[model samples]
Target: MALPSTTVADFSGKYVLNKQLSDESKFDDILAAQGVGLLKRKAVGMVSATSDVHVYADEGGVEHLDITAHVSGGFTSKAERLEGRVLNWTDKEIEHPLFGACTTKSKRVLPAEVDAAELQNGWTPECTAAGVIFIQVVPTSGTDWVSKQVWGIEEINGEKRHTRRFLVTTKKNKTVYARLVYDYAGPL
Candidate 1:
């Protein structure tokens, strides 16, 4: 199916997480590469987390994204703005079920790349709006991890929903270490 043509302006709303999919066996390698210890990795897998994404454009026409994730016994949030330049910010140290409490400086870039053919295959035109990418420098391990998250709108059972694809790459090899999928449950 051909996706409708859309721009960044179309991604202005709250997207709730409905589902998460990943390869369980590869979780170890993916987590260890980010400096996550064995015990912490196990904890990360046992806990369930729900993420809600909020996107909007500011007065200067810059796209902004705020992702709030609720996990077992705690929650964490990160915000980024895409305005063509690399924006830097410090993410508060938060205990993650998956990564533990590691703090680092985050770099974000807006309007990342999206495959046109992939977008046309049951994905929304708004998927192109998901070009926001984030990079984090791990202080302890000195590993640079990059993440690109995109959202595609699709109709499921006549109900409009959004599917988010998160890809994490290791800067050393530039290989995709992990891929996560999350479905939207309407607004917040």
Candidate 2:
């Protein structure tokens, strides 16, 4: 049965035995008898057919589960850069002790690299076989715009029990932007 779509707050651990699938008697018997390659729900995040059930002789049994699914969606954000350069207030102001004492400086914010090729073609593997759907940043070029800060990925649910992580950064004069996204398929 398909569960309702829900946001995954976090996924990074080994969960205890929950329950075994009881709908398919044949499959259930097979599972109880001989365990399959459990933790195989890396693709769907719900290891329905991949769960293993071990029936103990006396008391409790063992249940190995590995299944999960992701709610399809995206996340986007935007921030204003410092532009070319900021004004040096000290230079325009009267000479005072405060001017000399001022030592703190603002951290420069660089423009996003919204490239055209990236926008059209998308991240080679991020948006394709990898399973990453899309990524678009600011500074999206228009008219005579040079480039943009857009990026995308193609996400893929690999073998069960394996988790996924993606790190983002900016390259320019000074580091100013960063983003991290991840999805845990399930443990086999």
Candidate 3:
């Protein structure tokens, strides 16, 4: 049976979801501070939403806060032997409106895997992955709250689209507070 999908929220192209004081320039500074070290591990910052440059508000009077923020901690290597490639992805799944995890793990590469020539000119490491892979870092370590996300697909007229909600929690061990309920329309 198909799931009962009632609402269709389309947050046009994309946007940034900023929390605290980390957005745009400040966000760039954070990356700069990491320098080459960034290639080593994972990092997090304010969710900055960037889209067409238009504002949208639902009938409820709440601003649609859906966005696709630029993420780092994607790929890096040393020793030059194709050690490992990383892919930093977010929770863009709809249905559950619950949680997500690091879909892709740092894996070593091989020459025979894909001709060295192809590797040198491969558009991106993600292109190498064989199947539909989703790389997301599940936020459930010790903190709580991972709700401000969804994955959307457009429709014919590009008016009412479909999307899935993604949120995370630490069992009953709650910490932060967040909610997911909005209608998104790209910038006009």
Candidate 4:
């Protein structure tokens, strides 16, 4: 059977984190290169994050996605308009479950166009401006490192859910992968 058609609007709702998995061995080097202390790295590997997503159109018919994510005992929120512009934000320091006080700087690039075909494929196309790809640069004690996050939606067990994948590539070209799976909690 064909999958049910999905639109950006289908993803609007509060989603609670259900599962998270990461490759620890691959993540260690990426964290170390980012100057994360040993203790903090351990803490990062254990923390869980949740997200809420909203999609709407503006007066000019421009599409926007507002996302709020709670992570490591703190929260960060940002909005991306599908106008091909980058939105930047610096968040206040929050108590991290593993790293103590932590602040974050992020840049988000929204899809320039929304393609229904992309959403149906179980992965958001990097070309279409439907989902969001964001890069977060966290400055640690010694140096700064970046984590790239891609957001998408997929149908799981006959229900559509929000998904996020994190990619952290070390200076030496090693890469680590982590994922967060969220289920719909309720309507917006």
Candidate 5:
């Protein structure tokens, strides 16, 4: 459970994936939609993940959230976003273990700014009230899919969980969705 003072608006802590509570049944399908190889997808299904998040503001007062995620087996990725005060996207090039070289960007966004309702709604009340962080990624080569994700905090089984909703769509229009739930570990 999250601390009483914690809220969707400022969830700064380390969280570990609760595989048992996460909606991972469609994870392989989402990976397939992203053109992940059969073996890679299988490997992904066996791994656990964690995210260390930091939410703070720069000297200029622009809020920023930095997330450092590590998937078991030594694979780690970092994502940075401009929070509530800014809605603009900040892009970066990363060599992802699953998606290969990709261009990604993230920003704080409102539900109306999201293209699909599935990606927009379905969050806990606090999540809807605090808004969400939006991310988009496109492989530099090989794959023809674009993945969009939304991050927020939600109440699951009475505990505040760090949740992520994924929407991966291929050039051929094959789309897949998945939800990831994480247990709050502690302050980062």
Candidate 6:
């Protein structure tokens, strides 16, 4: 557990998934909604994952964030580098073992900028007051679906936790919502 005084809301640090505190059971359903194959989903669900987050601002005043995902046995599973500027969606290709090729758009936004209720509500008051980071992911092939996720610092069980809420929507209109909570492991 991290001391409350040292936690940063900037979302920079190392965090390990607290499966016991997260709605992890719903992850499979969320993946399915995104058209992930059964075998891959099962493999992902069984592994313990951790995140190494880094947030910074360039000299031009543009903020940036990078998150590297590590799975069990010390293997890096995925990494995403997001720019924190509001603009039209610029689709970029990314490949992941579990998600495969996908296009993503990400930025930092004020609470008021978020129009989706699922992504806007339920943030910790501190984060809601400061701001939030948003990510939109779409598979480049297979069933058409979109996963919109909001990242913020949430106070859970008297501790500040790194939290993410994702809403997955398919072309058929099916949707799945899930929350992932991570325990502060240490500084990155």
lDDT of 6 by residue, 1-188 (tens): 53345323366888888888788778789988877789878878877887787777667866666777777744455554432333234666777566778888777776568767877876677677777788788888876898988888777787777788888988989888889998878888
Q: Which ten residues in a row have the lowest lDDT in candidate 6?
A: 80-89
Alpha carbon lDDT of residue 186, candidate 2? 39
Q: Report the C-alpha lDDT of model 1 over 90-112, residue by residue, as the tens digit.
A: 45454443444445333333333
Q: Candidate 4 regions off by >4 Å?
A: 1-6, 20-33, 41-48, 70-144
- Better structure of 3 and 5 per lDDT: 5
Q: Model 5: residues >4 Å from true position, as ranges?
A: 1-4, 73-87
- Separately for all candidates shown, the number of backbone clashes (residues 3 or more apart, or on different chains) is 2, 32, 21, 3, 0, 0
Candidate 4, 154-182: lDDT as tens digits: 55566555666566655566556655567
lDDT for every model? 0.46, 0.22, 0.28, 0.51, 0.76, 0.74
lDDT-better candidate, 1 vs 3: 1
Cα lDDT tens digits for candidate 2, 50-94 = 222111122343211122321221312212121121112111111
Candidate 2 ranges with C-alpha deviation above 4 Å: 1-151, 156-172, 182-188
Error of 5 at 53 (Å): 1.4
Q: For residues 27-117, could you state the per-residue lDDT of candidate 5 as single tens digits?
A: 7799888888898888778767777887666788666767677667544543433222232576777777667799887777776689977
**Model 5, 159: alpha-carbon shift in Å?**
2.6
Q: Candidate 2 vs candidate 4: which has greater TM-score?
A: 4
Find the 10 residues in a row with the least total lDDT in model 1.
Answer: 78-87
The TM-scores of all predictions, comma-separated, are: 0.53, 0.16, 0.23, 0.52, 0.84, 0.85
Q: Which RMSD values do the candidates have, in order?
A: 7.1, 24.2, 18.9, 8.0, 3.9, 3.2
Residues 71-164, candidate 3: write the lDDT tens digits.
3233232111111212223233232111222222312232224222312222222223321111123333332332222233223133333222
Ranked by TM-score, the better of candidates 1 and 2 is: 1
